[model samples]
Target: MRINVLQHTPNEGPGSILDWAEVHNHEVYTYHPYQFGHLPTADETDMLVILGGPMSPNDDIDWIKAERKLIKELLDNNTPIFGACYGAQQISKTLGYPVTKAPAKEVGWAPVHLQSHVIPGIPETLQALHWHEEMFEVPDGAELLFSSDAVKNQGFVLGHHVVGLQFHFEPKPNNVREMVVNDFNYIPGSILKQTKEDILATKVPEENRAVMFRILDYLSQ
Candidate 1:
């Protein structure tokens, strides 16, 4: 399977998703919109993974608009898509749901309360990495899988192959560090957000890694 990942920024690349792709022996191709990388058509991609970024889905950018069009095509064709953060917002916008400012900016490790069953054997609550101020709304036909105290629509599941997570499950410890280092100012000094040291110290546990792998496998199916 050819899993195509859309990367909006250098720091926010496909972290553990690369591990999943390698484990399954699936071909993985990453496209950098900032660099104008060639984007393959929906039929050429087995799965599309949209990674997180600092930008908003409502940005007046050409590449961002183009990506949304591709996402719409993928949705119409029932292609498997997994979006995180900004990527998730993009999906929601293309699905006719508007992206709005979250109640509070959820940064670092926070617990997401699972509201529905998207993956089997999943915990009722899990500590997931988050770094977005804007949140996506639950689409008309999508199921609200889980949410956090800071944000209600943290995740949604559309049909059998489409999923969007407002939090960061794909980022490994190093990836989290990179994100923090690159955009340290984004994490405001608030009770809801975490400090750089605290965020870095709390490593991405093996449990979280396993859960991410399971979720990816579920979407790939």
Candidate 2:
């Protein structure tokens, strides 16, 4: 299977998704439309994986707007997609639901309560990294999958194939460190948000990769 990634920034790669793809013998390709303006062709992408970024989906930037349009087209065609953080906001915006600033900016490891078994095997209340101030609204006819105490809409599934996750379950320890170093300036005083040192010190548990692979396995089928 060809699992293609829509990478919004240079620092945020596919991380554990790459590991899952490799383990399953799926071909992986990433398009850096933010830097190179290279977009993926639909013919080459069996599964579309959208990665997180600092930029909002509401940004008036040309590439960001173009990405939302592409997402709309692919979703209309019923393509399998998995979106994380900013990527999740893009998917929601493309689906006619607005992406708005959350009541709080969750910026560290927190518990996400599973609303349903939309993605089977994920723990009911699992620890996940939350790094977004903006949150996606659940689209019409979609199942509300997960929610954190800080963010009500942590994840959703529009159909059997379309999944949008507002949390970071794909980051490795190095990836987490890089992400923390990259966006360390913002200091929102939400109780749910944690300091850089604490976030960095917290281990990336095996369940993170396991849950990531479980989602990928379902998406690829």
Candidate 3:
């Protein structure tokens, strides 16, 4: 399958997802709106994976607006999509759900409790990477699958193919380090922010890699 990925920043590129795609022998193409500022039509993609970024879905940027249009087209055609953090917020906005800023920023490793059985292989609770301060309601016709203490709507699913996750399941150790180096200012004043040493010590990535593959396989089906 050809999985077209929409990336907003260089530091936030697909991590474990890239590994999974390679191992599964799926063709993966990435579009960087922050750089290339271009996007593909829904017909060019068999599946879509939107990566996280510093920008909010409500931003007034032209590329963001264009990406929304693309997302809507993909959804209308029932193309499977996996959205992470900012990517998820984009999905919510396209689905007519309100995306708002959270009261506090959720940084570092946090626990998300699965709230529904909409997807199998999702544990009742799992520690995942959290880097965004934005939150959104579960879109209409989507099942709320997970919730965190810091954010109520941790994840949601629209049908069996469309999945939106507030926390990232794709960050590897090096990826987290890059994020911390590039975006540390975003966490300078947050009480929930973890130190670089602490973030590097996390074991969450290894635990979540399998879960990420499970979801990917599910979407590929």
Candidate 4:
């Protein structure tokens, strides 16, 4: 299988997803649209993984629009897509859902309760890394998979192949470090947020990685 990744920034690459793909001997390709405004065609990729970024899907950028177009085309063809944060917003936008700012930004570890078990392997309650201030409405016909206290639409599954998560389930420890270092401005000094040290101290990586593997395995099937 070939997995094509759409990366919006240099810092946010597929962490455990790439690792899983590599271990399973699946070919991987990446498109850094921020650096090169080009994207891979659906014919070239078996599955698509869209990673998070600092930018919002609502941003009126040329590349963002192009990526949305690509996402819509892929969904039309029933191509399996897994998205996180901004990537999830893009997917929601493509499906005619509204992506809006949350009442409060969630920036640390938070428990997301499972609303449905369509995705499988995810526990009823899981602490996922949160870093975004935006939340999207669940697309029509998509199963609302998860929800948190801060965000009502934490994740949703479209059919059996496409999933969009609002939190960072694919980030490793190093990925978190880079994100904190590079996007330091996002760290608000509020109760809902966390300090750099506190975030680095979490033991969510191993469990998050395992869950990510299960997600990929389901998508591949």
C-alpha lDDT score of every prediction, in listed order: 0.87, 0.86, 0.87, 0.86
> CA shift at 41, candidate 4, in angstroms?
0.6
Per-candidate alpha-carbon RMSD to the true structure: 1.2, 1.3, 1.2, 1.3
Per-residue alpha-carbon lDDT of candidate 1 for residues 1-221, written as tens digits (9 for 90 to 100): 99999998889988889999999999998999868856778989889999988889888988888998899999998899999999889999998889998888788888899988867867888899888888899998899988998778999989888889999888887898898899888888544656888888896867777878888888877
Global Cα lDDT for candidate 2: 0.86
How displaced is residue 4 in candidate 1, in Å? 0.3
| Candidate 4 structure quality by residue, lDDT tens digits, 9-30 | 8888798898899889999999
- Superposed model 3: Cα runs more than 4 Å off: 191-193
Candidates in order, TM-scores: namely 0.96, 0.95, 0.96, 0.96
Q: Give the better candidate number (1 or 2) by lDDT.
A: 1
Question: In candidate 2, how many Å is residue 28 off?
Answer: 1.0
lDDT of 2 by residue, 1-221 (tens): 88889998766878999998888898998898888987776766688999999899888899888887778778877888999999988999988889998988888888899998867788888899888888899999999989998678999887778889998899998998888888777646656657888888899887988988888787767
lDDT of 3 by residue, 21-130 (tens): 99989999999987888898888999999999989888899999999999999999999999999999999999888899876788888888988876677788888888
The 10 consecutive residues of candidate 4 with the worst lDDT sum are 184-193
In model 4, the runs with Cα more than 4 Å from the true position are 189-191
Error of 1 at 152 (Å): 0.9
